[model samples]
Target chain A: MNEKNTISVATMKRLPLYLSYLQSLSPDAPVNISATSIAAALKLNEVQVRKDLALVSSGGRPKIGYKTVELIADLESCIGSEVLHEAVLVGTGNLGKALLNYNDFGRYGVHIAIAFDQNPENIGNCVNGKEILPCEQMPQVCAQRGIRLGIISVPQGAAQAVCDEMVKSGITAIWNFAHVKLIVPPGVVVLDEHIGTSLPWLVGHLS
Target chain B: MNEKNTISVATMKRLPLYLSYLQSLSPDAPVNISATSIAAALKLNEVQVRKDLALVSSGGRPKIGYKTVELIADLESCIGSEVLHEAVLVGTGNLGKALLNYNDFGRYGVHIAIAFDQNPENIGNCVNGKEILPCEQMPQVCAQRGIRLGIISVPQGAAQAVCDEMVKSGITAIWNFAHVKLIVPPGVVVLDEHIGTSLPWLVGHLS
Candidate 1:
């Protein structure tokens, strides 16, 4: 990883797609795969794919292209796929429970260690094996676990308060599913997963 | 909307964020708001915000900025927020159920009219008032309802098959939560919500 060459967010988002594509290939598939083929299969631009792959791996050969196994390894390492990052989830609602039940997070190197909710009934309840704790215990639990990643699945009204608690507990990165924009201090990275936005975009583009 | 000046996907994604911010403001908030203020509130680049706003609105005035109410309307119209898009959801798993239970989609002009599942136990089951239909009935139900949008929340192995059924049912736009990239016709749009990608990106960026 070269410090000088910063990967753009667009590229970062596509890294997993590329990884998924590579991983999906059969073991008996070609040892070397060209960027053009990869791009074609993924419906991405060839030049863009080449540039994105270059950031993580040494440039592919002129004819032979990238070695499949080596490229996958480079992608996994670059995307931090091998490291199991423990994250705490706030709000054990439908979306939160869905995420907690989602088994694919382990493939991306994330584990929802615990869930916290303000609702009394939700506390002590288990969703996908992880216990949901009271909201009051969030800060202490997160601090004790040294959890830096916080997932906000709380409702719009409660998202900010949950975010504040997460930040106070040393969370630096936030994956916010709530519609509201969070006010975080400098150095805090917030990825707002506004699922609502995509629908409108899709509908607007419909011919 | 001007077809000549096409809005970028990046701009489309940010429109909802801006709308959410504007909506969050109190009724007593100033009638006029500037791109700089919007940028500051959202922690986005001022120039980018101005450029995005320009695409949907008649460019803002030099001193008064934009009329808040009119700007909101322009955004709503541009994003097709006024029209309720009927959509069919495939897979009655946790993610699918979460989406069906999601009330916020109505704000984004989307209504999941029906849900489909292959499991016999899940079929005919109701979630958030909408009943889950058999997967075999998906094509017929979607086609009869004239559904243009389809949400694919099925597991990886089943995603492509569901996508195929969606396309067959006249679904031109797909909100795919599945990890696999669906191969659709040139005009068909697929917006993939790869939730797993964000965590690794967040973890990788952590200091």
Candidate 2:
């Protein structure tokens, strides 16, 4: 990771999505892509894409745009590529399983290291190529793996405890799906994906 | 619905969440709940609650506070009371099923009208108590049931078409979960809940 060219978590979050969009546009085309094209696909301003890309690199010529493979590789490095990031899932509900089945990670260098479920039936099963670890074994495995990002899909009741345990296990970021508002240490990041809160926002500008 | 007290969809979205938080708290305790307390529960501002509530009534006193139950009822009326809103699910993916199984809506007025799936195998069954209707039946069911809100949980590729169909069916608001930006008519509201974009905002704030 280059200390001089660090990217914000905000920019890192968009990389995978942007990569997916860009991949659809040009499969074997040259890596160089225009900020204008990326902005159009993501529905963001070209200036915004340029500003975000500035955090990563500007080696791509303004005429030729950014090199796709190079820019993606650059993004991975910006988000930390020296090591593979291990992700632990808490709450193997429908969403938990859905994420496990999502196979779009190899290119992004993100992998689901393990899954946790209190259900006795699901605890020993292999899900989406990853073994489902018991809830009791979560802390131990997380510590062993040095996992930094924790994904929470548990019910709202168990969400806070899951978050607390994730933080205690040395996790740095939490991608939360539980409808509960988690209480985390000041530095820990929590992303809420509660469909209820989100759906309305999407429709807010509609009518 | 009272014309003068027409609650904006934005305010309606928060009202149910607010009510849930208020109900989760002590019902017997009559202490005046302040905007700050409501804000803390939902991770919003006191002024937001005050302004949102202002659309309904100027009830909350300066320092003393708002009566929880009374405020909840008032907010409910402003959101909706008589005509129950039935919503059609445009895509039946994990996100769609998660929404179907979502039990929180029973408390609020929103009810799952039906779910539509592109796959024939999924078309005949019910998941989470909602029937999975064929995608072909969307326009008919939507018009028949007078559904106005369409939940777009389809893959990004199918988002635009389903949204267009929903709009043609007279739906004015769309809960768009597909990772694509929609070009919709002025009256049609498309609420974007794509975690890819929103998670960044949260990560940036915490980072």
Candidate 3:
């Protein structure tokens, strides 16, 4: 089967920014908004904003600009929010707990079905109402659920092992939060969510 | 002063990946390796690897490739790790605590000298030995310390107020983790670290 329409990764990253800003505005505040307004508010280029918005189904009017409510819905579909994703997280450390408590995930259609940890003290506990199961049960539970996305929040030493387990358990895509570079086999997608990279990128601009 | 040598943000993001990969390899293991080997290992293009490595001071030999040790140090300098940046973090929530405990920051020359929170119970607490102070003291302490980098890990509602306090106290750059797009007056750099964006980007690829 053919895949859905594609957007560049750079453009995909900016969609959430536009979505959140649109969500912040009152439905009564403006019937339509020009790309120029969004560009000014978000410090983005006007042409880029228009290009990104054009990827959505609904097009902007010549003078009235994009319809506010319709744009939000288009963005939601563009981001695949219509299809709720139930995934598993394999770490209950501080970052894992932070990801659990992060409320924004719900808006984006991601729900952590369960979290796994090796710590005996944390195994029986709960984070944001999601059970923290033993690492041994990860493969069984994730496979039984047919989960597709796996989040690796483990330490650098344990990240690869956890990723292998996730892939072995039927996870097709992995969102890695570990510091090290993971080696995943072919056909599996890995998104390295390295927060440290932002520092250098920001510093480069600051310099 | 003239700004240090420049590289594109895309190239800057990949430097850490190469650095970490190089750090994993033993210098004695390979006297010389070509960009093709590095590209194959990381699933990146050979030309891109060569292009990125060229930005560093040291040059690669025709067939021997770059000296691993020199490349590592050059990558360190490329990312500005040689200059340790002392910054402050506000919001000692789960995410804030995660940031404090993240050991990778030290390797990147980012030290969260202090963290601030409004929670009375957490004000006197500590994470990774760094004191968590009241928000009221942020301006004073940051001003006295001459802090230039501020990290806002607070909730959406409180992010702007925390950012304002940081700016008022002389913070010139901000690493914001809040879900909102902040309005910073000109001169202050804000890097919004949104984990949610990754989800859509990943989904876009998966679909």
As for model 3, its CA RMSD to the true structure in angstroms is 2.6
lDDT of 3 by residue, A54-106 (tens): 87745588877888888888887777666767889988988999998776676
TM-score against truth, every candidate: 0.95, 0.76, 0.92
Report clash pairs, candidate 3: none
Best first by DockQ, ranked: 1, 3, 2
Ranking by lDDT: 1, 3, 2
Candidate no. 2 TM-score: 0.76
Return the top candidate by DockQ: 1
Where does candidate 3 stray beyond 4 Å? A1-5, A26-28, A204-207, B1-5, B204-207
* DockQ per candidate: 0.57, 0.28, 0.53
Every candidate's chain B TM-score: 0.92, 0.79, 0.89
Instruction: Judging by DockQ, tell me the better candidate of 1 and 3.
Output: 1
lDDT of 2: 0.70
Cα error of candidate 3 at position A124, Å: 1.9
Clashes of 2: 11
**Between candidates 1 and 2, the DockQ winner:** 1
